[model samples]
Target: MMLLIKNAEVYAPEYVGRKDVLVCGEKIECIADEIDRLPVACHILNGKGLKLVPGLIDQHVHVTGGGGEGGFHTRTPELQLSELISSGITTVVGLLGTDGTTRSVENLYAKTAALNEEGVTAYMLTGAYGYPSPTITGAADKDVIFIESVLGMKLAISDHRSPHVTIEELIQIASKIRVAGMLSRKPGILVLHMGDARSGLTPVIEAIERSSVPIRTFRPTHVNRNADLLEAGYEFVGKGGYIDFTCGMEGQPSPGECIVEARRRGLAKELMTVSSDGHGSWSNYAQDGTLLEIGVSKVDSMLQELQKMVKELSVPLEEALLYFTSNVAEAMDIGNRKGHIREGADADMILLDADLNLDTVIAKGQVMMEDKRIKKFGTYEHSK
Candidate 1:
């Protein structure tokens, strides 16, 4: 299949001005200023008055559903393909969250595979929020080295629900992942679930400081959950570590605000990224460690926040896009093909109208959504 998008203001995540892009099969074939010649059976899209950008890459989604804080009944439902396409997500990383017991890593892998087979690109992490990390292959390191879709491992720290893994245990996990990542040529990262506990990023900081493991081995998320954590996140970034901010968290500073503040503090923009935590549970806990309330996160929060960043917060479109596009791809070590809109990259992109509303979504050279309507649906989505 061939897709040609013409006369669109492109932000290959870096403002490339008006240009035409040709997508052949699942890769971008060419990006040029003018191409009058056409290929037989080629599909041409009129991109006038539209903004073309790389499709959003969400690295922290609960694809098989997250949450169980309240009870099993409160656990969120698994993600649907239409939800991701409508939100302009072309590549997503699935993972388990609090309930690693009931939600096995095997389920996460299956959902990741299903998403890929359904059209969009998907990957998953092994383990969850507990110690002795859960794995489909009996070990986290083995999962990374053997499982093709397994990118890294997930663990929580400083939160009440966490297993309170000691610093030694944390180092061991990082070391194992680091070695396996080298062997598998994967990122082999530890996606730390930053909690609201006062300890904040202490374990992560000490783990890096006391070991030979590189700073990038640890990817701490939800840094904006509290003022203290965000401050600690700054220090982590200063030490050459990347930090991810979660969007749509109530009572937390918006990701746009967090990025602006990080800029003001002279932090490197490349060290920062944002994720929706889609389908994950958001809960409020009392001082006594009781869950007060809980709700599922929406997959569209990243899009909403991007609009707010560019329109409300006055962030430049190119600058604001990094949080969802290039930055995430770089963090996950998939920048070579996942992010950017240049030739030789994956043909994953979204088109936005003048008002910054999503109009089209193309994933792996397939038109998943067009004119703000989903054209592709999961196998069971529309079935009676």
Candidate 2:
């Protein structure tokens, strides 16, 4: 159906004036001062007094399901389509974490394909929480180079549970990623799963200096989980590297505070991103290495973080929106299609009421939620 959204106080993450957006099928056909005239038989949405931002792109999500660190019983179930849609997330890049054995790359790949079939955009990373990452082709480079959905490999760095890879090992992995990305024209980012190990990002910086891998290739996440990690993240951002702060992991410093502090410290704004880490376990480690406690992931944390940035931190709406949308899109090299509201772009958008409540969620021109109610859900979500 052709749809026209009229008089939206649009913030394509920027204050574009009062404009109308016309969507044809799954793509935006026009975004201008006025659509001139609406097509016959088209649905019209009066967006008066509403803010329109690009639908969020969460780069580091366990969409297939994460958490098996505590045990099989503690394993979090896979995320449902509505959980993401209701949270204003339109595109997601799924990754495997500590449960690579039970949750294979094949399953992650299949889940991504399934989400696409269900009308939500999804992509994935290869490898998991181990050295010598498991891949469908038995090689990380081959997977990223050949598979369209495979963007790069993930490394568990500076965490006690990690493989404790040396700079040489990290460099070698990044080398393969570089070559593969060069051949495939993909951004072969090394998505690092960081923890509160306290070793800091020194090793990562050294690895970049010693190898051909650019600083932008090393994407470290979980920066807001701790004070020192946050400081290290700012340093990385200053050095032209990107940092990802995960929402829903509590008991550390305030994530909102860290983001505000980063801005105050004059860090590059475009290099920052926020992800949900949804469905992943947040296991706390005691001083002696015992698992103290854990928590289930929440899909709403992405918006929670965004709200914190805008409300508590007094961050402008435009800059706040970029953390969850455009920054991630640029980091993953999906800038053309995802993470922005533009003509000829995917019609993925979120309409927020004046109170910042998610009122409408549109993924690929299909309304998944309206008036705080979900209109669509995943295949197994409602199964008895």
Q: Which ten residues in a row have the lowest lDDT in candidate 2?
A: 248-257
Stretches > 4 Å off in candidate 2:
none
Tens digit of lDDT per residue, candidate 1, span 101-220?
Answer: 999998899999999999999999999999888888899999999999999999999998899999999999999998999999999999999999999999888888888989999999
Clash counts per candidate, in order, are 0, 0
Superposed model 1: Cα runs more than 4 Å off: none
* Error at 276, model 1, angstroms: 0.6
Q: After superposition, how far is residue 229 of candidate 1 from its true place, in Å?
A: 0.6
Q: Give the candidate number with the greatest TM-score.
A: 1
Please list the C-alpha lDDT of all candidates, in the order they appear: 0.93, 0.86
| Candidate 1 lDDT for residue 146 | 98
lDDT, model 1: 0.93
Write down the TM-score of every candidate. Answer: 0.99, 0.97
Task: For model 2, state the Cα shift of residue 174 in Å.
Answer: 0.7
